[model samples]
Target: MSFLQRYKAGIGLGLYAVGIVIGLLFAILVVWADFEAYDFQAGLSVEQKTKGFSCPLAITSNESGLMTAEISNNSTRDANATVRMMHTLGSALVVNQVEQRLTFSPGQTHKLSWPIQASDAAWDRFIMARIYVVGSMPPRSTADYCGILLINSPFFTGQQILVFTLALALVFVVVGWRMWFVSNKQPAIDAEKSSRLMIAFAALVALNIFLSINSEWLASGPLLIVNLLLAVAVLANRLNKSTFS
Candidate 1:
C-alpha cells in the first residue's frame, strides 16, 4: 500500500502502538527508581489523605520493627511533600501514635519511626492503616488513597489490558451499519456516522483517561462487567450473522 493508503487503513493502530510504548516506559521508570525503597508513605497511596487528618495503623508486634520507605522522585523534578498515617485498632485495645509531617526531597531519604503499644486487653485485631499526603485527599469517595485503584481479581485487571477491544467492536458496528444498514433518507449519514465514531472514540478516550487518573479507585468487578458483557455481545452478534444473511 502507498503511504497515504497505509495511513488511512491503520492510523488507529499506529496511535495505539505508540500509546502502549509510552505507558510501559512510565511504569518502568517508577519500578526502577523504587525497586530498593519500601517507602509507602511517599507514593500516591499516601498523598490521598486530607489535611488535618489522622490515620494510624495499629502494629501489635513491634519487635523493634523499623519500616523505611523511599521518597520517590520519578524524574529530575523535586516535589514538596508530607505524609500522615492511620491505623485501626481493636475495640478492646487502644493505639497510641502521632501524625508527623516531613519535607520529602529528591535523591534523598526520610525516616519514619513510631512506637505502637497495646493496652492490657491484649491487641489481637488485624489492623489496617491509611497513609495520606498532606492535603492531598481526593474529593471523590470512589477514589481510594491518591486515586489508587485496588484490583482484587485478575479478571478486572485484565479489563485494563483489553480496553481497546470494546472500541474496536463499536467501530465494526458503525462500519457495518453505515455500509449496509444506514437509512439513505438521512443524507447526513456519512457525517453522522463519522461524528458518532468520533464521539465513541472520545468516550473511549475519556474512559481511558479516567481509567488512568482515577484507576486506583476502580475495582476488578467493573472491568469484568465491561469485558464479559462485550465479549458475550460480540459472540451473539457473530452467531447471528446467518440471520442477517
Candidate 2:
C-alpha cells in the first residue's frame, strides 16, 4: 500500500487537508477580527413605540459563561419593532467600539451574547441597555433591559486557537504556491485547464474551516486558497476516472 493508502486517504484527504488549513488560517484572522459580533441581529419587530414608554429587561452572566440580555415589551401597545445593541469599550467610543440592531420581535424575547474583549463586555454589566427601532410606528410602551459581564471566561480558547493558526497558514502557503504554478499537477483538470480555479476553490475550503475553528475568527485570503486546492483535488479525481474509464 502506498503512503496515502496506508492512511486510507484519497480525495478525502484533500478535503480534510483543505479543511485544516482553512481552519488554522481563520483562527489567526479572528485574533484581530474581534468585531464584538453584534452585527447580526437576533430580533426584529414591526410595531410603533411612544417616547415616554420604557421596557424592563434582565441581563445576566450564567454558568455557561456567556453574557446575556433579555428584553420584555411591557406595554399595552403592540410594539412592532427591530432590536440591536451598542456597547462602548473602556467607557468611550474612541477605542474599541461596536453598535448593532437587536434581533428580537416586539412580542419576542431572546438573549444576545458576546465574548468579552476591550469593549463593553456584555449585557450583564450594563444596568440599562438601550435599543433602537426601525419601524416608523412603534408601540407606545415600555421595554426593559439588563445585561451581565463575566470576567472573560476562565476557559477562554483564544490562546489555544491562536496557536493553531500557524499550521493553517503553512498549509495555505502550500495551496497558494501550488495554484500559482509551482507544480505541474493541476488541481482542476475538470474544467479543461484551470489552475486558477483550483486555487480559488482551495481558498474557499480553507475559509470554511477557518470559520469553523475560529468560531471567533474570520478568513483571510490564504484560507480561501487552501479550500480552492481541495476543490481542485476533488475536480481532478473525477477527471482522472472519466479519462481512464
Candidate 3:
C-alpha cells in the first residue's frame, strides 16, 4: 500500500485541522486590524458620542446620502464650535473636508447635515466627524464615526456577515473532521470523491476569509450560505451508503 493509503485517516484529519486553524487565525487578525485602525483614527482624547451621529452603514457604489449630527450646547454659555467631517477610504481621504462653523446658545441644539457620496470603488470606507469648541480650555471636543460599505448590494451589514462566517466555520470544522473517518472506510472511488469534496470545502473557506478580511461582506455573506448548503449536501450524500455504490 502507498503512504497515503496507510496514513489516510491521519493525513485527512491533519489537513482539516490545519485549514480550520488558518481560517480562524485569519478571521481574528482581520477583526483586530479593524479595531486598531478605528481606534487610531477616531480615538483621540476627545469624547465620542454615537447618539448624535447618524449615517447609513451600507450604500451602493457612486450613490449619495445624507449624514447628520446633532450639536447641543448644554453649558450655561454661548458656544462657538467647528464641525468638520472627513470621508476616507482606508488611510486616504476620498472627498474634500466639510466644515461648518456655528454658534449655539445655552440649552440649544442644532442638527447639521452633510451630503456623503460613495466612490465608484467597491470597498469599505469611513466618515469621521469632529466637533470642537473654539477657544475652550484644554480643547473640549467630541468625535464620531460611521463605516460605509460601497457595494451594489445593501442586504447585509458587516456584523451580520461576521456572525455568519464564524457560525459556518464552526460547522465546517466539526463536519470536516467526521468526514475523514467516513472516507477512510469507503472504496477507492468514493474515497477520492470525498477527498475532492473536502478540498473544495477548504478552498471555499479560504475564499470566504479573504472576502471578509477585505470588508466585502456583501459577497462574503452569500458565499458563506452557499458553503453551508454545500456542506449539508455532501454530508447527506456521505450518509447514504447506496449513493457510493
- Relative to the unseen true structure, what is the C-alpha lDDT of residue 217 in candidate 3, on a scale of 0 to 100? 49
lDDT of 2 by residue, 31-55 (tens): 3223333232224442432233221
Instruction: Kindly list the per-residue Cα lDDT of model 1 for residues 135-171, writing each as its tens digit.
Output: 2222211111221111223232323433443455445
Better of 2 and 3 by TM-score: 3
The lDDT of model 3 is 0.57
Q: Candidate 3 lDDT, tens digit per residue, 61-115? A: 4466676877777788877777777655334444346678878787777798877
TM-score of each: 0.28, 0.30, 0.43
State each model's CA lDDT, in order.
Answer: 0.35, 0.41, 0.57
Which residue segments of model 1 deviate by more than 4 Å? 1-48, 51-130, 133-202, 216-224, 242-244
Q: TM-score for model 2?
A: 0.30
Two-way lDDT contest, 2 vs 3, winner: 3
Candidate 3 ranges beyond 4 A from true positions = 1-43, 48-51, 89-95, 120-139, 153-245
Residue 83, model 2, lDDT: 43
